[model samples]
Target: MSDALDQLKRHLAPIIRLQQIDGLLSWDQQTMMPPKATTARAEQMAALESLVHELFTSEKTAVLLAKCESALADAAPDSDEVRLVRVTRRDYDKETKIPATLVEELARHQALSHEVWVRARRENNFSLFAPALEKMFALTRQKAEYLGYRHHPYDALIDLYEPGMTYADVVALFDSLKPALIALVKNISEAERQFDDSCLQGDFPVEKQHAFTQEIVQALGYDLTRGRQDPAPHPFCSGFSRDDVRITTRFDPHLLVKALFASLHEAGHAMYDQGTPEAYEATPLAGGTSLGVHESQSRFWENMVGRSYAFCKWILPHLQKVFPDPFAHLNALELYQAINRVQPSFIRVEADEVTYNLHILLRFELETQLLEGTLSVMDLPDAWNAKMQEYLGITPPNDTLGCLQDIHWAGGLIGYFPTYTIGNLLSAQLREAMLHDIPNLETLIEQGEFSSILQWLRQHIHVYGRKFLPQELVILATGKPLSADPYLTYLQTKFKELYAL
Candidate 1:
């Protein structure tokens, strides 16, 4: 059994490296790839995907997995070997169900779709992206059907990013959060907007934005030797290993907060990647457990740390050095309050913490309708606008600010929006737990130290890798199961103080 399991490991190892290679190429595509290389990049990805999918789901793997099961029977269930075998087997079972051709097609189309999304978002023309979105959605639905779900097609997609998650589960969770969120938002609407964040609007240059962001991320414990920061059309964080994390952000010369906060957000993701166990490198267990769990780390560091009063205090001196014209007069409390101010917005990435969940809720509802055929794709703009007005009390001026803003729908990432909320909820709860365990967390942050919080996450959450599901991690980190109470309370407390509500 030992020898057989070793053989199984041997078979799986190179495929993992293939996945990393693919990830690196994708990082390049988003960060440094030139326009002319788009088509070739798509072909390369499709070929790699086809090979990896076929190799991973081969008939020989089924035979080896039997021995793996026997070997893992006596091993601790939480062991990395057990986790790798179990998760790989599950993936293999699902993959072998779909035709390799279908898998290849999805990969090819996903590559093509990213380019389309970039063009559509730039051109501000949804029609340029409509056909691709239609094709991608059709493929996603078919993939869901192939994977076979008990309730909704979107559940299959959700399960890919978050193990053991279902559409019904998210729907029930969101149903509970909606009323509280709506009420809190209503309360904010009545509060006076006393703070004018016009200080963030000045003669800020992109070069300064980049340099300042790099400095802030470095101070926040994002290792520059292993990771990199680059500018992209849309901001994102991607990683192949702790040593190779990459984050991207877009800069606007006129608006200062966009690039600064985006860097902090992506830096949160980088920090998580850097925190993973070094032994797990080049294996399935090396990286984030799932996207939702990953988002929690990013949002936790980005909002809870970067926007916290302590963080503002620590960074204010350096900000005065980098962009003295804008931040010289702004005090730590002022920057903290300005960045934390509650406001409604169309873009999810740019939305403040208080209303970011609302944006996700809207997408979650809209996507559910789209999947059920209750809403037509052609009418998505109107539906999106109606929801925008209904939720934020303002309608988008165009598809660019509305339907075309997010690349998720265009890339066929249905059922992903809700993860943003889940991440936030978990972040708030986890942060609370950390504070309980280490009372001087704020003092540490103020002193430019993250040892306590980072150590807490590493021990409680990051070290586990993919050994357990998000549900399991939540319970381990927070004493109770997942709830919105911590998140809602956090938001109310922070924003009430900031906005003087």
Candidate 2:
């Protein structure tokens, strides 16, 4: 059994390395690659993806997996060796069902479509990006058919990001959350605006934002020795390995939250990557268990910690140092209230915590319609604006602030939006569990101390990597199944106090 496990690990190492290389390539494309290099980069990425698909789905890998399974038949089910084999086999079986040609095609189209989306978003022209989006969705539907689903075609797509999560499960979760969120949004909307965020609006320099972000992330235990931060059009985090994680955030010279909160969000992701167990390195188990679990960590840091009053108090001095004039008269509590102010927004990435999941829910509904062929790509812009108006009571005047806002659809990430809401729910759940264990957590944040918090996460969440599914992980860490009650309670308590509603 030991010999077979070693052989399986050796077989899987190169595949993992290739995937990491792909991630690096994607990071470069989004961050530093020259605009003219798009064509060559797309071709290169497609070729690499094709090779990876072939390698992973090959008969030789299947035989080795079978051998390992046979060898480990009597091993403890929860042992690392058994878990690795289980995850790898599941991935292999899924990959083998889809053709390598389809894999390369999707990669190539995603790269091209993403570039088109950037241009379309900047130009505020949906026509410019519509054909590419249409093609991507067509391919995605085909891919879903290849993957196979028991009930809905979208089920196959969602399972790719969140294993074992069905369309029915998501619908149930959303149904449970919608009334509470809508009521909360209505309550906050009716209340007079309590905080003036005018202080955060000023001529902030990009350099200062970068420096301050770096400082805060380092203090939060993101190892600058093993990772670095860069700028991107859309902020993201990529991990090539546990030792080499990279995060990117965009800067808005006129807004403080753009870079600040984005930095914390991406840093949360980087911390998760950097904290993966060394024993799982160079294997499928070395990264996050799912996109939902991954988003939970980012939201945990970005909102539960970064948006808290204690965090504002702790960072006030550094913020004053960064932009002395704007923050000169601003106290920590004022800044905290301003940052947490709830209002409907056009851009999903910039939405407030209270309204953020509404944006996701809007996308979730539209994407499901798109997958089901009830919504045409040509009509997406209208549908998006309608949803925005219906949900938030404000319609985007243009496509840029509407359907063209997000990069997910362009990148063929149809089923990824729901995870943001799932993550938000889980973040509050995790925080509830953490608070029970660490009652002085708010105090620690106020004092700019995060080592204890990071350590607690490492022990409870980060170290396991992909060893368990997201539900299992939540149960293990929080001693309960996934729920929206904790998140709803947290939101109501926080916002009712903030808005004095």
Worst 10 residues of 2 by lDDT: 190-199
Q: Candidate 2: misplaced stretches above 4 Å?
A: none
Tens digits of per-residue lDDT, candidate 2, 301-388, equal 9999999999999999988887887888899989998898888989888889888988988999999998889999899999998999
Model 1: per-residue lDDT, tens digit, 344-372? 87788888887888798889898888777
lDDT of 2 at 131: 95
Candidate 2 structure lDDT: 0.91
Q: Write down the lDDT of every candidate, Cα atoms only.
A: 0.84, 0.91
Candidate topping TM-score:
2
